[model samples]
Target: MPKLTFNIFPKEAHHGDESVWSNLIGGPSSFSLESRIFHSISICLMGISCFYIPYNLYAGLYVASFSAFIFGIFFFHQYYNSRFNARKHNNTVFGLIGLLIFGVNYFANSGIHGSTDLIWPAYLLLVFAITPYRQHLKWLTGYLVFFIIVHGLEFYYPELVKYPFLEGEGQFVDRISTFPIPLVVVYITIKFIRQSYDREKKAAEERAIAVEISKQQILIQKQQLEDSNSEKNKLMSIMSHDLRTPLINIQSYLELLNASEVDDEERPVLERALLTSTNNAVEMLSSLLHWSKSQLEGPSVHLAEINLLRSLQVTLDMETAHAAKKEIIVSYQIPADIIVKADLDMLQLVVRNLIANAVKFTPKGGLIHVIGEVLAQECKITVTDNGSGIPVDKQDKIFSIKAEPAIG
Candidate 1:
């Protein structure tokens, strides 16, 4: 535990075929799955022949011994070419060799009652595993015909058949020894197939998860874009109406003065009105500049120490003048020593909007009161007026980009 535990299987969750185990069986990244299977089975066959060669020799079955030796050499050569040189084993050569050797072994052994018949099916299975799908029908049909012709020859000419096994004991030994060949072939082939299937399933699942995450990110980006567009539209609407109306008021006042339409008491009244419009226009223009800057270079918060009463007094004074036009009484209650950390422009914008809203909603002769108070560690500001209140159904979800800005 202290030192090392080598990861023989590095990419287990969703690994490619370039693992160490994969490379040992077949050339990694270069070989197909079928080629890997071919190499694996060839290696197993080579080992099986090592046992068979000696066993056949001891049993005095020289032809069987020779066949086993040949099988070992053929497979060893194939394994070397495939695993070491990264060469594809010749399927056609391998299939033809199997047919020739087995045909000879059938007659040399006890024809129709020998282990050659037992090994035939396993060999055919190996051929199909290694070869392409299109060649399957060709090999199967050819093997079937060969098998039929051999048995038919034995039926017609009994003298041509060899009886190499002396009795039950001899036949039993041959069958038992030959049993391992098919068993090993089936075991390795099925195991490799199952492993390949599991790897594919795991890779598909990971791809699905990645796709889902990408889809979620796209959805979040879409929501953010929609919110930004809505904010842009709101700013444009405010600038067109608020800033333009005040400038138009100043223009009209100048026109009236130039025409000699205002005189004495009326001139003072017109000057006061003109001053109010100019101030409102300047404030609106300043807010518009901040909005434009934020649009050009994304919104950023700048928090600083602010003298709360002193900063908001200007906004309150402006609101009071607007309220006087409607005969609505406007007043405020704020501690002079109340200092805060906040963005000055944003703080003033929110307060001004709130006071303006209250002035708009309050009836003639109504009282609009602005109050600033300390609540524990935080500061709270409220603009209240004797006006029609929000409905219970509408109060829970009050603010939205789609909702009207003013309600009276």
Candidate 2:
């Protein structure tokens, strides 16, 4: 089934509430909604007056005819002003004109005994709708005071008033004709109020839902952090207990071998044991430290303009000296002015690690090349060496922490 949506007023009027009464005080900054209401009411009054002017003329009521015609002109003028020259249509002045027109009709038509009394309250309601919220109490008081005074004057001097309709169908027609003004006024006022209430209620509900969702996300993140810390602590305990003893044993044997002379065969075994243990300890510690830092402090990247060539040159110089011991050739092709956006220390660390690995894997007298180039928006750095790379089967795991460390 197709969904059904009910809207009392057009979507434009509902959304443009601020503009509905442009001259009203104490409303939202935009007057689109209020302006819409002003235009709509003006059209309604114009239509009503059009009918009444012809009816009054046919009935030979020149006074009523002239008044209805004037009302028609006033409504047309206001409609145009609100539609185009909105700034010129002062809200309070327009409201007073409506009140004055209705008040005059009250006395001129039948004084306190006419249909004007029936339309007076609704006209005031219309005034309240178009006026600013802050001015509502004042308008209400003024209307009520004026109403009482009119009734008081009529009560005191009944001879001073005139009755427009005779007792019969003419009076009935006048009452029936004036009925729509109040009816339309009340309907529009109630619908506008209801629409505003619904919009505010819906907005509040959405805000509450958003706040709850944020709270849930925060709770989930907090739980994940707790689990990560628990796992890291357990891993730390295992590494400290299991690895430390063997590492210490290797170090003690190296110290002992250094302190005394040993047979060639025993010395090689001790050196090999110390070397294996040292490599394993270094790799394990590196993985553990990286994991712990990430879990506890999170990753932080500080970006700055870095001289890529200078950073790579430094790494190459350090690695080249180490390579020189094995009679390896280390060459670099780096432009001096090549710059990139990166964290200086992080970039240097990464380059040093890559070059050091290349030096370790390359055979004696092999060439190692460190090159950098600017490719579009990125700076590409390459480290190459004439060394046997990782085995095809282990290639995928080379960057993983669990990958076994290999020595040249």
Candidate 3:
């Protein structure tokens, strides 16, 4: 079956209240504040003049009617320039037009007693609203001087001022008709100014928020750098002290080998001691080199599947001499088929360090165990010793660099 649909409004009209309002305000972001203000005020003045031009003619003031007609033409054309011609409102002829027309309209349409007096301040406000701030004082002073001179000229030369309105009744009628122009002028100007102020305030707040976020990120980066530097200092202190111990052991063994009274059986023991010292030095140096690399390039992991027993065998063999020195029974059991995925360098480093620590702290003839277990989701390799272990309270600090208590 075919269905029919109907839309009441045109697709363009469906753009909603904001879109319509934006067009009224010269498409929001497209127009400058001055341009939009000029356009808005022009529309308002054109409307006011439409009513006054007819009203003035009907009231028998031909001079005021002609003045309104002139103003209507000016507002319409200037509105055209602001909306379509100029990118921003820079017209100053409005002020000159006001001065010229109002000057003639003043004398012809009952001088100081006419509606021109009511419209003067409103026109000045419109001029100030569109013009630059630096020109405000100049315009204000010029308008003030013009007002005083024109009023003074009429006051001294009474014959120059004409009376179009007859008496109090005519004056009252004139005031009523002329009042709305200034009222609408003040309203439009103040409204646009307030809206502009609120927008500037919101933009300022967003800039402040962005600056604050950037500062916080910079602070975080600074703290990380400080922590890294602190760790580097701690590592150097530990390495400088630890690295000397194995070197001293090797030096003493070499000195004994050079002695004349060295026995045949003692040679084997000395060689074993030398091997232990060499292994310790190699492992420690490897750890130091890895630490230096991490500081320079940051950390990286390369994961791959590897046989657990095959990986640990070389490391275990290196530790055999150290174990023999204390007569510590070091044993490990892992199924040959126990495969795990890991970064091989990082894995070997961790295991070598654990076994070294075990051999360091364990008492004479202590049993140190290295065991590997495949759990439901993961693999666990543990190196443990049957020596006085860390106290429960101190145990948690083992992996923490800041408050790491001594092992022995």
Candidate 4:
């Protein structure tokens, strides 16, 4: 005996609950429209089949038509309820009712003539096969029960087999015995196709997600590398600029010391050079520390309205000794009321660098003038020198990373 499995049953247990099946069935009125149209056609066909049954030759047609009409009316009412109220209960009940109507009709119609009724079982098998797998088990059980009852009736009342359609039917029982086989084959084929489609969709979604994640990671790494490179460039610029002046002063002082006699009058001049070198080195270190702090920690601006003339006076006073030793005359022309919003430390560094550069490049007796003016929205501080001014061609490249002519 072939063991019955859930797969073999006519109507499958609703395995996935109502939520799952609702998604599969889609929204309300979608399947209902189709069901309504099918039932309406079947009702029309049943009415036509009744007319044909008047002729004995088409007697079995009436029975088929009557069965179709009964099932159609039940299905039509179910579809009507489902469409109006959006309910699954009606659909489930209608399906069960369809199975019962078809089963009973098949047995009654087949009793009169076994050969003509063989096709009824084949029709039932097709309907069960085409239905969704979740509903197949229940229908299959109904089919089995109907089959056993019909077969028993045929055996007990052999006189019911005298219809003309059975005379030339040729072994009706044997020919239709394996009707369930074709249904099983079709069900398996559909199930396989659906499973394969779902697997491919899932794989594609996973691949898309993986690709997106990779793109985000690459973007993050690129940003980190750019930030690191920027910091390195800033550090190198600070080191090169801050170290140049002190090293030059030290070299000049050492050369003078080595060339001159101990009793020479230029000994005091050499001592002044040493003092200037030490001061320049200290200023450079301080400037570098300030720049580094600004870059690393964050903006630390302490704004104040400072008198431009007073600030210039203070800077010139600080650099006066070095300027006198170099024969560079420091002068200033500014309005007393000129004020600007600035952070004192940062403005001092800016002015100091400009003054130091002027003294370094200016020849003996060259004049270094600090000028200040107030515009409508901004204050202008200018450091001008009579020594060799920056060449026109090198001015643009002064801020470049390569060596360039100095500004006086």
**lDDT per residue as tens, model 4, 154-248:** 68966553332344443353235324333443444445345546877998999999999999989998987776666667656655654665566
lDDT, candidate 4, equals 0.58
Over the stretch 243-356, how does candidate 2's per-residue lDDT look in tens digits?
443355455767858876787879888787667656655654565466446545654676899788865554455456556657889888989998899976567656766776
What's the lDDT for residue 68 in model 1?
88
Query: Candidate 1 — which residues are off by over 4 angstroms?
Result: 1-24, 84-87, 234-284, 291-303, 375-378, 406-408
| Model 3 ranges with Cα > 4 A deviation | 1-13, 24-30, 87-90, 159-170, 236-242, 276-408
Backbone clashes (count) for model 2: 15
lDDT (10s digit) by residue, model 1, range 254-309: 77767765678788888887787787668767876786668546677789999999
The true-versus-predicted C-alpha distance at residue 97 of model 1, in Å, is: 1.7
Give the C-alpha lDDT of model 3.
Answer: 0.78
TM-score, candidate number 3:
0.67
Going through the candidates in order, what is the number of backbone clashes in each? Answer: 0, 15, 0, 13
* Span of ten consecutive residues with least summed lDDT in model 2: 1-10
Superposed model 2: Cα runs more than 4 Å off: 1-32, 224-242, 258-269, 279-408
TM-score rank, highest first?
1, 3, 2, 4
Which candidate leads in TM-score?
A: 1
Kindly provide the TM-score of model 2 when superposed on the true structure, using C-alpha atoms. 0.58
